[model samples]
Target chain A: MSPVSQTRSPLDWVKTAISRYWGVVGVLIAWQAWVTITGVNSIVIPHPINVVGDLVFNPGVYLANAGQTLFLAAAGLILGMALGTMVAIVAWSSRILSGILVPLGLIFSSVPVVALIPVLARLLGYDVKTVLGIVIIISFFPAFVFTAAGLKSLPPGSSDLFKVFGASRWTRFVHLVLPSAVPNWMIALRLSAPPAVLSAMLAEFLMGKSGLGFLFRQSATEFATERAFGTSVIATVISVLCFTSAVAAEKFINEKWK
Target chain B: MNAPLSSAPATAPEAWAINVDHVGKTFTLDGGKELKAIDDVDIKIGQGEFVALLGPSGCGKSTILRLVAALEDVSTGRVTVEGSNPTALSRAHRLGVAFQDHALLPWLTIRDNIALPYKVAGRPVDDKRIAELLALVGLSGFEKARPRQLSGGMRQRVSIARALVLKPDVLLLDEPFGALDAVTRRHMNVELQRIWSEQRITTLLVTHSVEEALFLADRVIVMSGRPGRIIKEIQVPFARPRSPDVQRTMEFHHLADELTLALEPEGHH
Candidate 1:
């Protein structure tokens, strides 16, 4: 074998890594070039380097706010998914209930869900609980709709087989319906994860004592332009991480379920 | 090998394993109109007997099978098994059924699919029985494979093994090999015959193939389409352990021709 084929060099490894992350590298290069060329006032749009400097110098501020936001988002997501799944199971138990709730769920899901945040803040009072509630409401509809669809979409002829096998209603639900619904449920999870985080931050921005959203507002008002931009960077990182993890979880479940 | 057959006693009031007593079915369409699918159809299957309901497409032969399997209720009459309602048999987990779709759970391994009836009945999973069925179906080495990974014929074999896992008192097969090619279907028929001979469970098979019905059934009942009713019944004269050679016999050909003629369109007659 040729030496090049037998042993890969350090330069070859670097070349592969660059090719894989070229898009991200290109975006960073373009942002730096645009800032340098325009020389826009730092107050309007901080330099990328200034934002990085803010993040590095003041880690405690970012860390505390990010921790709070992540906690609220994760907790609210769990609560909303549980509530949605319970309601779906209740609807599945009765034709009359399903008929009543399915259309209502569709209506609620189609409505501008984020638009309700202000109204919810007014009604529930501008507290951390309201922020949590907003995230819950944002995530609930997809879980309900996707799970309802999954419960009904059984393998062809398997329902008849279940009936003929003398399966009880509970047995059928446990073995057939629940397992079948898992992949769709994972789809709902992946679709809702990033939005869950975004909505939590938005709620915090509207009326919260502390969070990344509050930090952004505080920094901007005080003319700490670099700190505000740093908050945005952290928020973006968090959302991407949440979305990537959700996608990975969905792939894992789909492989097992299908 | 002579399997022990569970034939009913001669003095028993219900000697029949399955009785479709003047059963009729009517289905409602999208509109308020009613379409009669079966009309005054009657069938009696003896214990340990293999009977085939043979009819062309659109005939209610499958409807009759569905009635006996308790998948559908008769609109005008009753279907009974062992002197009780068909639903009783199903509820007791003594009825086995295989449909044309195979109906194997795609997510489950072949062994788990066979063991599903046990789980449904709230009985412990019998690993030995599942292994035995896997061997019987000629799928011993494929126990860990999923249904989608197998060929169509192999999937149907897994379906059949699942049906027999509980050693159900009655077996209902609705064109289990209907999705296969001609050669594969014929091969399935031979395998099914050997399997049925060994089990000797009371079986009702629904199919449109004249040769399949004759080759596998102890008796063949032909039905007419559009408000399905029995047109004719023929007792298969072939002995047990019937090999593929029986299909080449003159008697088999004559019976096949008769059944084919029965299935022809009314205009042709």
Candidate 2:
């Protein structure tokens, strides 16, 4: 509110950077230690070294597949988050809407969507549209539920404050309800991201070319367990990266709006 | 007699700022039960009058204030502000409110918090008005300070300044000083009186403390429970520019005790 300096001090920068990477550093060191001590078969858990070599040198044979998977997941996640927030606004605005959306969303979520892959293939034709649709369906409901509940959960006094001010519907969405609901949205996104990634993978496995899932299916056919294992690790790292970035973005928004 | 508020405010009383007539509210519990929060509330508050809706907890004192502020609707009657229906008063700058909690946005600094209504309505922040508000609330030096950086009393002061920045026709304060320590609350009471007198703004405060209600209000309306309704109205014959010393006078206690007795349990009566 005040005219304060925009830049962080050097000490503040160091603190922020360390906090962000602390888990990553711990994971690397622990992973190296585990490889040295376990002496397990390389097929089950390739040394982090071999995984990194494949990640860098093979430079995305599977990574390219991973890139495609990431694209689908990212697109699906964004569509889901945006549309989910809008659904929440609708649900919150009218009791009738909540009633309608509740049963619709529940039924949508029930009946394992993975089972409908062939239906989707029949409709959208075995392609990325089909894969992203899977991600959208898997990712959207939780976001919608949380966003709706979060908006509705604003403290009595807060809503009253907005009401007294005669705030526009959109204004309340952008200001009062949105800022207060950041924590809930973050929790939903964390819950939804892994499934969204998995959904994309499943769709890719079922559908076609270019994705870590395709690599996974191909490697399984060849019985190259190490490559499959490596691909799995790479997939995991991608998920973590995606989830972490989403979480960090949420945290930054929370802090800025706090 | 529940009715929508009218948008017409083409003409209004030169004397009174708020008018209520048998306005009431009741909430239906989850199982289709009803809880009466307020009932048959009627009051004609003059322009620039400092009044308190005082009663014990659950007496619906706060509910009355919220109704006038247009935060909630009346169940069976009507309420108006500046001779206009509050519910239909669609402008954001018309009423300034401060509640028990400061409710200052933690993200914004003291100045921005004060300047928020303007900025939120797409009007640019008026720096001069912001500075004047900060100076008035004794937050002049901390304009850039975030709500979290300030102490409790300091935060409440910022809240007050924020409410005042818009120069609202009425100021609705719901136990604004209740959360502060003894000393800070007393100091704020004095500061509030000064601001009220200087601005000549109509104020409606809801409070449980008899002395606090007595010290601040020009007239205090006491209410009774369950189906909450006004039980008595007592006038504070005290002089203007209220200071802490005015609290020690016999007249203050006389009114305080009268309001307190009105709020006591009905069995004893």
**DockQ for each numbered candidate:** 0.75, 0.28
TM-score, first chain, each model = 0.90, 0.76
Ten-residue stretch with the least lDDT total in model 2 chain B: B1-10
What C-alpha lDDT, on a 0 to 100 scale, does residue A153 get in candidate 1? 88
Instruction: List candidate 2 segments past 4 Å from native.
Output: A1-57, B1-14, B22-42, B72-78, B88-92, B105-110, B119-124, B141-151, B225-232, B250-269
Write down the TM-score for model 1: 0.92
User: Positional deviation of B4 in candidate 1, in angstroms?
Assistant: 18
The number of the candidate with the highest lDDT is 1
The global Cα lDDT (0 to 1) of model 1 is: 0.89
User: Model 2 over residues B1-269: C-alpha lDDT tens digits?
Assistant: 11112223423443358887778899889999999998888777877778888887888888888888887788988888887888665364678888898777665667777877776566778899988888888877897777778888888888778777778888899999888888888888888888777897788899888887888888888888777888888777777877788888887777767777788865865
lDDT tens digits by residue: candidate 1, A19-69: 889998888788888889999888887788888899999999999999999
Q: Which candidate gets the maximum TM-score versus the true structure?
A: 1
